[model samples]
Target: METEGVFQSLPALPLFLLMFSIIYLIAYFIVFRNWSPSIRPEASSCLISLSHGTPAVFLATRAILAGQNRGFAASNTVFQNLVLDYSIAYFLMDLLHYLMFFPSDLIFIGHHSATLFVFLTCRYVVSHGAFAILFLLILAELTSACQNAWTLANARKGDVEFAAKLYDFLSPPFYALYSIVRGFAGPYFVYEMLVFFMTGVADHVIPRWVWISWIGVVLMAISVSILWVSNLWLELYRERTKKLEKKMR
Candidate 1:
């Protein structure tokens, strides 16, 4: 009886794969085929342009200061250094998302939304993930620049005050909310992917190329995490600088 039960269970894998494949094919043909093109590439380009341009403008202003012997060289260095740090952070995070999240989402979700909730949730996950990571990188850079500006102001006038205290006060709560939502999304995605795999549909409908893409995505995610850690180190460095400055005065 035990052997028979085991044998019977073995066939479920193929069945699961079959069901998943059929559903995926139908969705791909009927739904995805008709949907509007994604604007993600445009958004990504805009973000890169904004990030690169911000530092360029700062550097240009400092260059003018340096010409006048007003301590602008140091300012230029500060801005350039922060830009390099942020660029690296952005690259790594993007690489990771492409490698891990993209593949996992495609394999599991694949544009199959049976209800409005699922569809909205899927869109939110993909969009919010991109926006949040970009926002985090930008915020880190802005924070670093603000700290630097504060230090410079104090050096010149003997007192320093942050201009955006209200904004800073609100950031923590928003960041917390973003983290909570993003944290749960990953596990839920994996669960759904597992369900599709068990149904044997993943193997049947999802081409080999798609599977290969997923593997690449996983590798990218790992790379992104590594970069994120480096970015955190910069944050720590900023905090340490603040503490040291307080001790000095």
Candidate 2:
């Protein structure tokens, strides 16, 4: 009863963060122990994300649909706030993963930090503008399961034959899905969000710098994703070409 009361009284976001941390620990120490020592943390990270990504897409979309009348900069609905809290918790866990296991990974660390800033501000500071943010979340995480599966497969490819085969099988489709989401649809939505905010609609509810900064971070994330996927495509092409040359010989 005492513990239940304390937990019930705890604030939502921090409590949610605690739950994510517990999940990460269990994934790392128990579920993924057979994975490569170096890969264990990341695999666990991916699992943690798998828990959030697709669910977030649905939750955010539901929130958007429920609150359509409020417009883009309107105050967050209950579901929208829950989605934001869920995402903030995931990013916090992921950031800690990078910080603990791979401190040298500055780009990811910085990316997570920027993302948390965006979510934190939305969830706490301004409290409005979740419409744009959650809609963007839906776009960004639509491919999360595929990407995470591909990532885990790629990680295990060197030692595990099935993993290598799975990686090969999944890469092209995963890349296609990711390219469409991050490259095209996401950018289009960002443009819409920017127009709304910049054209003076979001201006009244969201601060000038706040909305600009949010969109700016999202644009940067999209640019990096595009570049990353472009490289992956080139690498896949090179691999296929090498195989074709060998077959001809």
Candidate 3:
């Protein structure tokens, strides 16, 4: 596949360092440095630190899983390949979110007219940039889990269907809460929208046909949202019916 060829042609080390620097900068400036004194009076709380560390923890766990799987060898070549792929993908999105989209806040906030533009812009930039990185890290973990399920199915006669279902069940609530907070409660929905667009760009890893299959899955998710709404209404109706029956009885 040209996947290897494309990755090999890039400057892997520099890109990796750049990606790491972006991650660090976002963590320090946004989460740690700007953390309100009202939230914490002393050293950062464990919860706060863990919240900041979640993305790294998630990625490190995935790397460990990938190493343990014989299919993904822990040798130098495998390490290099994974580093190159992730570094390129991560850096491209990081640059897009931090460098490109962040500066546009000036235009949206009226640059000079809005007195809060400076603070809002900083908050918006950091939140959105962190979100993009976090989302990509989650996707990487999910992809690894999917690969692991396939490996188990082929090599060990495991139930791939069960693994897939379990992963699916867990993903939605996480994504729902993330989407809500990132969309509604955060600085601006525009940032979340941008993150969503960047995610679509990152899905370029697969061939066109395979990518279309992913789009179909996304469409199915939209349908599922409709069904979820219907189900909620049905539950409410059933509860009301039970109450009427009890009153009559």
Candidate 4:
């Protein structure tokens, strides 16, 4: 089938959203219902994050490897479809979840909005940088499984020993992965886009709105990374100091 024809017939974006919405509903009503009210939504959200994130990591990795010789423009369109599908679903669910359950979480709302805007732009408007977007998706999703697992552990704070041990074991790797991906690579991706826009290296010049949305997405990622990492370090410091003070007694 012609690629464009397939895209038209498949309607990948809406199907993706519908599939994940069903999954999220199942998770919320069936899987996570036994959990405490406050924890259920977050736990369900974590599961949804992993569900999309795992495949994204796989598809993005494959695309990047396969595209090395051919370049992103020649990369498999399937990979692009998968990445955009997973992202659109995840972001939509996240936005809806936040709106319904945690409207005050403005940071996440901003993050989701900016990300969705850019993804939709790439899907419907400019389509030159699919490979870069997929690569960045991989970098972003690699930490989701770990981060959500760690978060779920912390939420069940009654398991103090388990939480502490898991935190200690997971903290280093999570921080490192998050830093490498969002902290460093995210900014690099933004820089490359800016250069492309400014230097006219791309086949077609990206629109100003696309550039603005893309920058907003990257900045949100970097800002969240800084805030989260700083808070993590601060918590670790407090925990260490408490232990130190107790030891002095």
The TM-score of candidate 3 is 0.23
- Number of backbone collisions per candidate: 11, 0, 0, 0
Candidates' lDDT values, in order? Answer: 0.36, 0.88, 0.38, 0.75
Best by TM-score: 2
Which candidate do you rate higher for TM-score, 2 or 3? Answer: 2
Q: What is candidate 2's lDDT per residue for 1-249, written digit by digit as tens? A: 574365346577887799889999999999998877989999999999998899898988888888756577898766677778889999999999999999999989989999999998998899898888888899889999998999999998998999999999999999999999999999998887877787886666689999989988999999999999999999999999999999999
Q: TM-scores across all candidates?
A: 0.28, 0.93, 0.23, 0.87
Residue 237 accuracy (lDDT) in model 3: 64
Worst 10 residues of 3 by lDDT: 119-128
lDDT by residue for model 1 (201-228), tens:
4344344444333334433443443454
TM-score computed on alpha carbons, candidate 2: 0.93
To one decimal, what is the Cα RMSD in angstroms of model 2 from the true structure?
3.5
For model 4, the stretches where C-alpha displacement exceeds 4 angstroms are: 1-8, 66-78, 159-161, 203-205
> How far out, in Å, is residue 192 in model 1?
3.9
Report the C-alpha displacement of residue 150, candidate 2, in angstroms.
0.5
